[model samples]
Target: MEKKLTKDDLKEIENQLSCPSGSKGIEVAVSMNVKNISMTKASIDLLKIANNDVILEIGHGNCGHLEYLLNQAANIHYIGLEISKTMNQEAILNSNSLGTSMNTSFELYDGEKLPFENNSIDKIFTVNTIYFWKNPNVFLQEISRVLKKNGVCILTFAQKKFMQTLPFVNTKFKLYSTEDIILLVNNTPFSITDTIHKKENIKSKAGDDVDREYTITILKQ
Candidate 1:
């Protein structure tokens, strides 16, 4: 199991994402979008994030999308937990530098045991990292502790069905299929809301099969 990343480790991850050509969000989104038609459809639903909800993300990884989402939601309070210091700091600095007035907090915290009071969150989400948990049961339980009743959580990842379609598959990251994720969801405290399978196509990619991802949404029950 991977230990919680330290500040230096966070910075290392940040440096990698800041590379202009490919990024954590861009790469994942591109591959996922083509993996299935439903992948893009599901991500579009992510924009339904309410203006007044308290939103949280477990593995922000220096992502720009969540911050952009926050900007779109002036009445929403957003928080992101990133294990990497550089990624967290870059997110803070770059986001603030953009001069938006959204209220937000970024913490260097353990993704497994979020340090929030019970029933404190309105909405929670993560992407591409839940399977790495050494104890996913405990991890989801912790998330349940902080979420309000009826609050929603969306977990998205690369689809196992799309393995044949990846433009460049990195063996480092783990991947799961929709059925696999549904089992984990069933074991958790949340009730399944929707499972969206989507395929994304990259410009000039050789095969039509490349780049699909699935996003699953569940409501805290």
Candidate 2:
């Protein structure tokens, strides 16, 4: 039998999908490990992380993927930027529990500004967080500013057609097609180097099977 979602459950899912800010949101994020696993794998694979690479992840909820990245390469420094205070702290705790605290750090921010020096980051990546970007240009500019010359940035998100099938992607969520994302990035200082598309079936919070199309766009700073 398919499990049903309550109104509060749906609300919490929406919060997790959008911003993931509070205690309830943190719980929802932890529960989403299954969905995040594949996306994280794809993003990491696209990242091509090297030894001693300075990497930053935007909107890293619960930091489960950070553990995966740390385990992939030794001495790779990672910084995570999240707008949610609870999630920021939860990610820090998650890293500590995984024994990755030595190389990982989390920061709470307003989602538009980045707190890194110019040309300081070697690589950056974000997954499933673009919908919550209040100002895409500002975030893109920040990414360009912090990334060293020829640094890589990988962005992973579900395409608009697939995202529209989800009930929680309401007005609060900003949906974008592949072209829209390309256009947005073209306006930034970075250049789109490659785009990878994949389709997968996943069960929704309401326990219904849904088909999702994931896009990973690699950019060079």
Candidate 3:
């Protein structure tokens, strides 16, 4: 047996930390991805968004984050992109279950190739999914093509800044840094808007109390 932080690591992590037993109910597996922030605090940042904004949520697992975002930006139009139909369908169901959504919807599409017109979206957000993007440059370019001028993208990860938090620990994980992501985004049409590093504790799928640090990066077109 080997220990590594690859796609298998994440998939196993997602499976372990999922709340509730079985695939029944809303199946909030992805919630563990952002458990460090406590879903409640994540909602606060989403509250700052303006009303009637056009939003695009990428790699939406079950729409828990989207539901929180919708609370503040009521008039916003939201579309979710997910590669897995099962996860995408679950996200749609979750969004609809949260009291008859009016402007929120879900789509089963690959995040690398989004179907959107140029300068159409006002804001974009992703949690715990950015690092998994196969072609980050193309993904960013597609995002740039769809973002309106002044539109912003906020990417928050539960463990992106793990390298900083565990400086003395050596782990077999491909820990991505804020600078790495910034460079990736900079290569696209968008530029960095803001970068903030913060500490947040999370409960892992294994029920381990893990303190994860994330660097929140805002990219603007």
Q: lDDT: which candidate is best?
A: 2
Q: Write the per-residue lDDT of candidate 1 for residues 1-221, one digit (tens) a residue.
A: 43555555445443443221234544433433243334323542563777788888776655456445665555888787876665676668756876643677888775567989999998887765664555777888888889888677777676676643543334333457777767876888877776665555543222332344445655457
TM-score of 3: 0.77
Q: Residue by residue across 1-221, what tens digits does model 2's lDDT show?
A: 65677777677687667777676777678767677779878898888888999999988888877767987777999999988888888888888888877898889888788988999998899998898888998789888999999799999998999889876667678899999998898899988989999999987665678888989999996
Provide TM-scores for the models: 0.71, 0.94, 0.77
Which digits, one per residue and each the tens of the lDDT, describe model 3 over residues 123-147?
8877666656777788888888888
Error (Å) of candidate 2 at residue 69 is 0.4
Q: Rate the local accuracy (lDDT) of all candidates.
A: 0.61, 0.84, 0.64
Clashes of each: 21, 0, 2
Q: Give the poorly placed runs of model 3, Cα more than 4 Å off.
A: 1-11, 14-47, 159-174
Reference-based lDDT, residue 147, model 3: 84
> On lDDT, who's better, 1 or 3?
3
TM-score ranking, high to low: 2, 3, 1
Where is the poorest 10-residue window by lDDT in model 1?
A: 202-211
Q: What residue pairs are clashing in model 3?
A: 16-205, 17-205
